[model samples]
Target: MKNIFKLSILGLGLALTLASCSPEDPIGSKVTYYPLITVNGDDFMSVEEGGTFNDPGAVATIGDEEVPVTTTYEGRFRGQTYNSTLGTSVADLYTASYAATNEDGFDGVATRTIYVGNTGDLVTSIEGLYRSTVTRNGALTAQYTDMEYVLIWKNSDGTYEISDAFGGYYDLGRAYGVGYITPGGVIVANDIPTNNFSFPGTQYNSGFGAPSEITAMTVDPATNSIDLTVVWTTTTTYTFQIHLDQVQL
Candidate 1:
């Protein structure tokens, strides 16, 4: 009886292990990787200084903790460093942690979907209509709500021009006081405000700024979707991660 019970337990363990394996997802029962995003019908690749391949992958941050992803590059995890070379295709849904990387590299978990590619999809490439919300901190007390404007991006030359004909507003105010004394009365004071008006707030605010540099771009062979990250250097540094489902017209 004892031998039968031990055999039964061992067989159940083996069955469970076999059930967890699949030919389709040899890595596990389910595949884990990154989603792809395409822009302008192009597959973006992560290249080096001379546009050389960098073994694209991704990164994710949950709360204040950053969870680095595993890819074809050398990465450190749990204080141990390891290198991941390119190999067979993996799963799309990563283990429920903080982050996952497929072919795209160093992107936030929130920005992961932008990298997931679809066939023949190209990204917007920081051109055409792009709106950014501008906020000021420390000394400057102002907020520009959803500044909409037309943008012309020069990816190769690394420059961009913006035209937001609609001018914004700057609040201004002042104070005045007057005092009068009568023969038999004490002093009387009065203050009056004189200027009060509004501006049309539409003017040609033309300026040229360095266009965002495309640090990385890639496309899946299966799905032609492209994923890219454009880093913009302005008075206020800003980063825009782009994933275009289709090429911009």
Candidate 2:
């Protein structure tokens, strides 16, 4: 009976040791994993008004294999009419959705945003008052600085106009005559006025001294900002850069 009892205890100890040596349950044994869907390429895009939209395509992945996905786009011009009081045309916000489901019945989704507008209507899109910072010789100086507000509007002849009050010598207003949009979406000023000098609010002539020209200009709709490189002749030829922030009002 003693020997039998000792053998039973020995068997129980061996069973416990074998259980401890067994491998752990497989990783994520109780968790369910779903396929991951990723939309490739630029999620945001632009299209000309009345133009067809082309999908950039997307991909869905399940484990190590690629799965089929469906992509769809829907857009409408939210504001179709122009507000004369506001001097701005309504913008069209476009949206696209991508969706996919794996064989295991898990679904994934992605989305995109787009802007649709007329190709040459930048003048209307950018008509408003803007806060500007003019940097000359890599520094902010009192002379030739119009750091407050600049006005931009669409002219009757379909060109764009920019008015920078106190932008010229002796605090005279600098009126940029007319600006047109290039095929590449750049805004080029027709010519810089050399003799235009007037105090904006007081109607006083401050007298202009030299000629200035806007050498280059670019607009970024994403940031609501305009960057300009302007060249002017004074005692010496000087180049300045203007960074403008569009004011909502």
Q: What is the lDDT of candidate 2?
A: 0.51
Q: Each candidate's TM vs. the true structure?
A: 0.19, 0.35
Which ten contiguous residues of candidate 2 have the minimum total lDDT?
177-186
Give the Å shift of residue 117 in candidate 2. Answer: 20
Find the candidate with the highest TM-score and give its number. Answer: 2
Q: What is the lDDT of residue 172 in candidate 2?
A: 23
Instruction: Please give the clash total of every predicted structure, in order.
Output: 35, 0
- Candidate 2: regions farther than 4 A off: 1-124, 141-146, 165-206
| Residue 45 miss distance in model 2 (angstroms) | 34
lDDT of 1 at 78: 9
Please give the CA lDDT of all the candidate structures: 0.28, 0.51
- Point to the candidate with the largest lDDT: 2
lDDT of 2 by residue, 1-249 (tens): 999999999999999999999999877644445667787778666555446556676777777778777765453323232211111233244456667786567788887765544333233355554667776667665543544445454444544545532223222223332121111112333432221121111121224445556556666766677676665566786666777777542
